[model samples]
Target: MMNDIAKMQELWQEMSSWMTTYMKSFYSPEAAKTAKSHLEIKSAKTIFFDDAQIVDGIILKEKHTWKVVKNCENLAKHLNLNEHDSLLAKMIGLFHDVGRFYQFTVYRTFNDALSENHAKLGLKVIKDLPFMAKLDEEDLATLKFAIGNHNAKEIAPTENQRHLAFAKLIRDADKIDIYRVLKPFLGPTDGTGCSPDFVDLFVAGKQCDYTKMRTQDDRKLVRLMWVYDVYFAWSLKQIVEQNYIEDIINNLVQDEKMMQGITRLRNYIQEKLQTKDIWQG
Candidate 1:
């Protein structure tokens, strides 16, 4: 496992190098500066995760970030975004979870309710980065807005279409990778069923409050309900293709109400899968 982890780290390092070179050649001088700053921050992050005292925690967090970065790039390609938009997508992905490291290191837990909102914490970290100043005012705000709202149950409203688009893109990318991160942890429930409020939300086809999760089953149900919040057909396609939805449903409690929600979700997924994913921006 350690060897596999090392290899994954090496692969990310290589990809970072390649991305830096590609951006330098393909982007304008100002954009190249932004890319360079991104590389510098990424390098620092790699070192911090590598040298952290908690080896296991750092590895998982680091791997998740890399996976989200890849998902962002793939989603951008799926949308056929222009080069500038593509770069922005990837940058937002890279920094979206920047607060997770601090949250884990000090609090020793990733639960925002118990600790801090990692998304907001990440915005503070990004705002202080000297290199971030290299980005123009508009790009910088878009980056901040996307990262800030990435973990929110719903994105905060915005009038700028470009800002909204990037926010949606990062949220989808983050959730897609999150399903993968949480997959291995799926298991038999602790015998305590989901909370009543959670069940009501599920039955209503709505998202449950993460802070209200009271049981393992509730957590599983919350993951299932995330399908309702997914923004893009392309993201839903990836989630279904990987069997995340099926796997979560299989592990969920099979009570009548749960099944009703499951039936509703399956029908929704089927309909969503058939729709074309057209990027509006």
Candidate 2:
């Protein structure tokens, strides 16, 4: 018992340091900057405490879980990964946001700014759990690398080719499912307008020009711009085939600049998918 506790502490300290370094380098500065005021935004605790209340939190959890399952199935088929790799990918996808559960339970907010990076918190959860002990050393390392860095802007520079490949796979799979989650919230909801700070992190390049995204509606357009960060041709093909781009574009406030950006991104992916050998090119 003493040995187990000590080992857990050691692992926590090591992972904590690694997460700090990785976030310092790769965490989205724009997200933190734009949403400074919302850093303390809290989730509705009443929803969690009330027995009779219909909570979006429970619905969101179930929906997110379903999305992860779909991502695992589709990615396994698309990538044609080996059995071990396929399992690793699926497990990583399933557990990637486990931290969010704890974060909301404790802090009552999904906002990482008010709490800690859910990725790091997830690592801690995995480490503390008994199930994680069953994984082989290499599989464990890959999962850690993938879950810890899936939300990062890009893979860490220190990561090797193998780690990078797994990271990219999980990242792509996560983004693909997120489209489903964003569908209900894309446009105006009720009387309360959206907040641009909500998506400032996802805003990147000219497609979501930070300066022009002064309103929540404009920032919502950044969801369509996720294609720019897609790392796999197969993932791009899946997005195109599913018409995720069109769905996002249709819901957004169609402006000339936003449409142009989406069109250019659509063209780029279409051309990439058309290539006979995408991996080589």
Candidate 3:
């Protein structure tokens, strides 16, 4: 257990070093200009949090736990990992959002569509970096797949032991965190209407069908349906256990037509849990 954590930390520190430098370049004045209209560059005050140490602690803990579970550690307790699995998960999670530093430095926001794909830029940084020189062939191969296609469409990995699952783990973990972060901040109590962008995404079906989800019931339904898109049932339970669905419902402004059925929403989740397979429920 300790060895896995230690190796993860080593890879994380190395990746962080590379990222800190890459961010320095990626968030420069020239870079901000390129990111215009997507993410506005905010003042340095917004670029960093009040405590650098806190950021490090949180990122390290979450990213490492995420990598382990995603690479299949949590799923199969006795599964022995070669150096490749550990290396791949460790390196990819560490670098996945280094582009975020640039987003803050340049765009002032983390919304992907409104901005750009941080994952894409992250890959560019890794490819351009010198760290590739230190990797073994297998190590590099795993890292390349994890880094390059971590955010792609959900598909089974064609390779041994399902390498792509490792990549999807980070994506699922990241989305769960997003739900946790944005749920409380949505600013509506009824869940009917949300920010215009949020509304439009649903209305257009460009996102899930939640535009008219005003009642707590509707909100719960939306969240239930969210399980369909979730990468794994483990991730689905993560949101449910965190009570993020309820938070989103309580935070949203209710659309009048959607208000009456709120209590039914919680019941629905309970109902589904009782009848559905736990792995899929």
Q: How do the predictions measure up, each by TM-score?
A: 0.82, 0.68, 0.55
The residue-level lDDT of candidate 2 at 278 comes to 26
For 171-206, candidate 1 gives per-residue lDDT tens digits of 999899899889987777778889999998898899
For each candidate, what is the lDDT? 0.77, 0.60, 0.51
Model 2 lDDT per residue over 1-281, tens place: 46544554455444433332322221123332332122221332222233211234534543574477468657766666655556566677767777776676567676676788889998886786655775667778888998899877567875366777778778888887777676666655233333444343333243344344445554455666667777777777777787767766665654554455566767777777765422210
lDDT of 3 by residue, 122-191 (tens): 6665676665756666666656666556554443456643455555655655556656544534445452
How do the candidates rank by TM-score, highest first?
A: 1, 2, 3
Among the numbered candidates, top TM-score falls to: 1
lDDT of 2 at 146: 86
> What value does the lDDT take at residue 119 in candidate 2?
92
Clashing pairs in 2: none
lDDT of 1: 0.77
Candidate ordering by lDDT (highest first) = 1, 2, 3
Clashes by residue pair, model 1: none
